[model samples]
Target: MTRPHTLLLAATLLSLAACNDAAPSTADAGSLAATITDAAAATDVVTPADAALAPDDVPAPERFSYVPMGCTHRVSAPVGSTSNFRDDRSTFGAAPDPHDVHVNWPADPSSTIAFLWRTDPGTRATVVQYGLSPTALDQTAVGSVGTAGLMGNQVTAHEVHVCGLRPDTTYHYRVGGEGHWSAVQRFKTGPAPGRTDYDVRFVVAGDSRDDVSRWRQLQERAMGGMNPPDFEIFTGDAVLVGFLQGQWQSWFEGARSAMSTVPFVMVHGNHEGLSVNYLMQFAQPQSGVSSQDELYFSLDYGPVHLVVLNDTPLRSDYEGDVLGTQLAWLRADLARARANRARVPFIIATHHKPAFASSSHSDEIDTQAVRRGWAPVYDEFGVDLVLNGHEHDFELSKEVDGQGREVSGRRGTRYVVTGGAGASLTTLGAGALQPWGAHFESAHHIVEVHATMTRLELTPRRLDGTVIEAGRISLTPRAP
Candidate 1:
């Protein structure tokens, strides 16, 4: 007899088959753009991908199986359904407006910007018109339709890449195709490639899966700061179930303001099951590390080099095999970043798991693969800062080595666990604090880091806009 989950999976497959028709021509006017249609026809609707939540076509791992440890009796149960989580008029504004509209840095921020958005199925096409002036959109680019196995239904996802843009210039842009368009938004580009000395700042936070209201509050405070971040990095766990389309919709709605403008670079948390939702949401730059996946990648903004890693060792092996793929890539990536220290003086690594979180999961006691695998690379390459989440509180570890010995800012790495965004706070146990923990706070907050040629400043702020703690690290000149 077919189990309930098997029956549900079959229905989901049928739905996917039905909705896989060719999308309407995305052809617009002279340059690649989509022609707008009437407002009535382009209503953006939230649709679930499946009746019961289950993993989609999970590709085989390149080296070994990519499942969490403790292999035993496996039951094909419905993880959960997406129907429970729905967006009910909280985020986004007005009718005929696009949903889940976000920008990302898939390439050089100065010359290229990638846009992603979702609309009603069969909307024909999507396009982005951008220019120096809001009224006169001199350049237009058309988008291609991609489908993701959302909730249990197949929904249309659109993406467009605008290239050949001027460096360090402000540009106004809007998204829609065939007639329906969104309100005009503006963004500034980073400095030209191969040049350093330009100051860089970004907000980093994560673990927003459980309490979205608090997540929305923290994001608003972070985005409304005096010196707004150039981009935002989510350490991981953007939603409770990474595969739930409804949860994603809610998250996008809550943080719409911040995301619609600045680019969001994300790392995949352990909660991000199978990573189907994670992969579908954003288009990322390809790193030639693993032929199996795009879980790990890098992005450069001004003088800062951001290395996003897949810390959760989903695959197999520990000592230099299967799961060691990322460790190998990280060493090489940081080597190149360190070599170009003059051009990219500050290298910050971010991932879901923390190497030294004290308030929440005690990394001191728990044997994390990240600490075992990546910590050595950070120490060897002299990575400046390591940003991580998974602990739902704020923690600042002193410049320390793998064994928790205090190392100077010149040669040591500072680890910050800024996982207080939207998730319930975790209290520090009586013996939780480690010798390297400089500060620990139980609050809903975000972390801001300012990178300059001579120094780096880290400030942790609460959801109500109060500063929790601030620290600065002096930059040491790169060796000749």
Candidate 2:
């Protein structure tokens, strides 16, 4: 009647890949797999909510619903083969990460939310028709930037940001299209500025490629399980450059159950760089801290300040990646945090590559660009924590003060790299093992971060839905 709780262990992963033995069958998983596989073969309708493999950007319109003559711009897409599950549509034509929908608004409780998404070139101007109640779709909102579309292989992305939304209010919206509007979606703005006591959640994961089943497991645990996260942070490299579209699509549609219910805060990963297609397709937080040039920005959630940055270009910046432009912005932001430290005590960041990897990648400097650029700021300001994905393993580094010295009593920034979400694994205990090596698992996993004013909790899911690693870090105000 009930399925075995999947174990987030290495053995479960081996089964998914048919690596060693048949994936250990749970009591109900086999039947569930068959049903899902059957659904995959039937080319009916799939939407963003069901989590089936489909378009990456928009959740499929309600399944089985037909579009009008010009509802959708028919671009070339290979029909999937006759299989229940696969990480790659290698048999199909090149699969690319589907264009995405990016939504955000300031924590100024009364700020109108901004909803942005990309569409096929065939569509004209983008607008979101939304309202608190789904039945009364009466509220019509517009974007400041008139119709903006960027071209890729066959389609173009449309970006628009709407404002003047009430803080912490939920509104349902549909993107522009001739047919039935995109599956009705909804999002709520952050609590008003200076208001910090509220509940929020954002799932964090990175380096998800190839082992889509592992990723699926993560979605199951995060969204399908008892509790779904509030939003999500895609730390980066959700897929590879070449031969990555299928992987990207899998990660997207597969996670629809979660994304449809929650918002995605996407951060550029190194793998995101190689995938020119990624840039062309997904619309992101592109203003203020991000403005037009860089994909770096700062946002506020209840009692937290969240920063997202690009790792690839930090080195090429005219002055310094973390020191110059980003540094200036970070300082201004931190200064604000300093004054309002009472309201927002936690400062966190999400970047793709990790500065400290204790696997086959431990000593490589290429991955430490963020550490090189922004370590000082983290040290100077007493940032609470940083999340990264790259290494094919999960690790919670030792607790250390900004200067890299291991701290004992309190007041330290913790660096955690949850790269095991789906990337290949490597041997550990060989390099860069910090005294802070609290937990390490040489397996596949998804990173789960939960925090409150007192402390932060991190748990990495092994493929079978079991926790492979866990760590707790305490947070406190800086000693003046």
Candidate 3:
């Protein structure tokens, strides 16, 4: 039987297709439409009103159906442009020297780690040497290489995966081929899956566009702490222009110190636009959505489940109903996370746009659209926190339900905008403090989260180490 929400979506899509002459062809819609249809057919029907409720209230899946009105193409460079970075050997050395090295967990965070780096086009070997001790680097992992055209410069990206690692253990590794190798860097693997006894710490920051110096300072501060982060959740906009090779080079150079050891879980920001640079630089877990795998993904670390969503969709090759497709995947993802609440007690969602913020982007169409579409799902799943960026300021919302109303105690999700990593600050607008706003600040800062099985303590700190109203949330494990 066809669900009411599915009928609404089909009607909406048909209406948009008929009225909007600029809409992409049905062929361009790809399998996403079918994926949504399949997802909807498997679930019970519910209205938007039925999904919004307090924590103790019965939960229902959110009904969100919206086709993008007019998908605007945002890629700055011409599509299908080939890279020419190797063409200029005088500027770029002929040797297969590697740079811009970083690490990510594309598989199990406890047992696997993927190393990504860039070398000259001439490089043929993609290898990583590692061991339990830096002195005895005995093991080797071989991987494949690919090419990307960034700002007219063609460079090779190498990805090597090292697995069979021990949980909560430290290992030293280096990436490169032959004579051009990077210095040995060390990283600690995550705790065993479903292990809630171990504590975890991570940093959340974003919007470092056009300010490399400030970003360098922020990275230094984040890594210089007595208890450095296990990893970083970057809210996106790593460069002023995502497609520009020089900007990315600068961004990576600034972060080389921290990124070499601490892996980054990135979100796609608007400044990244529709550039391939964003996709080429980092390796993310597959979202099982065919070609849209890298657009959104989720991972489990210690006692927390981190869901990363892509709310920034511009004109691109695979741009049909992005939010809708993500909504379907998100429902299933959160459902699984909810079922495993006994092991992972917290669900933290991160994305580029803020659903609740008092800054410049508060009233933007995309912000409101995300709020309308995803909030109810978050409320239904009892998401503990939603961290966001793109506002260029810091704002924390009181615990609120899907209807944007404050709920008693810990009955609703807390929305936080932590977009002040290194971007130019934007002041809160007049009357910016809404009833749901708990605090607002326009300073360069990063949010530190300390998570345990029973509690999560979050602190937003300035560059000078000043804490901005630390908040804590206590949790009781749900039935498995």
Candidate 4:
């Protein structure tokens, strides 16, 4: 398997990695013996109510015509280590898991965090609780998941965010039916570096679907290993866009271990967010009223300034809006980043569709338009790099200047499309390279980005854990 493929598969393997009673090998693809778990955590001192069917409350599978989507984590312990994880083992005819659960840590990785999950259809009452110690869980919150009225609604979910956590700390939690609480799970908040100077590792990929593919299994095991990344980012085309809710829920359940603890951030792809379900499922920072579908926003992590925008802006033609509101906001946000320049030295832009992709449909987008509008802003604001996904292939663009020349001048913008995540590869015509595309491959893969004040490096890997493409850039915060 290639490197990106290996990394994608790691997610499934991580669940069993820690249980093998040995330090996980960064190279293994086989599953190890490990414990399994779920989510029923109420964002409170104690779970407000039990969503899972009590032992006596559960109906026999033969009684209902519904397919089973079992109960998840049960966070009923008193805010400490006293909780244990388990499963209600809900079963329907040939069903894996139902009732999609979505979660996030939006409170700036500080004292408070948030999460969302899907409950049994028509079941509104639920519970979640947490504390440093199992004996002191005095916090509590109340929320419901799914359509309480529909009989066959497969698109229901539960959402909640936890708060008041100590920085750089780990706390235990559980969620589920009151009688069958999930095994207590643990998660650590982001490290509180004194002044945003620290090193962090995150994994990148796109186009992974939950409908059971060989590539999906490979990617799952690759991403589920012991030394998992800080978080996972899906660039775009994650799946056929425009589907109703719950379509991507299993994708979330399949990678619960890594996602529950790690903040999984997603950028709107050409395939997602047409409906409120997608946006509501994944909570993004408030992008004040920008055409109701302000599918763009920005965030600050440590010293890095990340700008996420929607490249698929509304247009009657094939190209995106040239002077639309998105561009204006991009200009203003970037300008503000320059005002307090030194605090954020690394500025990156992430969108679903790429400005340049070497896949079969490379010519679909108009490059001159991007360069004409956004590239200049990147040049003016000292933007270090641009990240995107759309093509079902992996690419790492060389550092280049505004004119598409190799950049030896400054921390100019470089583009990369790491989308071999799990979808079938979209073959290119040949060794086709665009003006700014540096390295390109037609392998299923992911990207691991490591950045610091002095340098930015990217490693693009295929599903089998092979580093097909790699590149680096050097720079200081100021314009050269």
Assess each prediction's global lDDT (C-alpha) against the native.
0.64, 0.53, 0.70, 0.52
Q: For model 3, give the 10-residue run with minimal summed lDDT.
A: 68-77
Instruction: Name the best candidate (by TM-score).
Output: 3
Ranking of predictions according to TM-score: 3, 1, 2, 4
Candidate 1 residues lying further than 4 Å off, grouped into runs, are 1-97, 150-154, 289-292, 313-323, 363-367, 470-480
Q: In candidate 1, what are the lDDT values of residues 1-480, reduced to their tens digit?
A: 113333332332332221112111232121111111121232221112222232446432222111111212111111221211111222222333567888887566877777777766545355788999999988877645444443343345566666667888888888875457777887878778766667778898898875779888878887776888888889887765454566778888888779888888888675554344565567566554333244677877777888987754332234543246777788889989988888777788988778776753554322266677778778888788899887788888888876667987376788888888886667775656778788888888888878776667788888887888543344554452
Candidate 3 residue-wise lDDT at 452: 89
Residue 208 CA displacement from its true place in model 1, Å: 1.1
Model 4, position 163, has a per-residue lDDT of: 53
Please rank every candidate by lDDT, starting with the best. 3, 1, 2, 4
lDDT of 3 by residue, 136-242 (tens): 98987766555554223344666766667899999998887566778899988999997858989999989887678878888998899899999999997776545
Identify the leading candidate in terms of lDDT.
3
User: What is candidate 4's lDDT per residue for 177-280, written digit by digit as tens?
Assistant: 45534455556676563356565566777766423363455446545666566556667655442232334654665555456566776776655523334544
The candidate with the higher lDDT, 2 or 4, is 2
TM-score of each: 0.77, 0.70, 0.79, 0.70
How many residue pairs clash per model? 13, 18, 3, 85
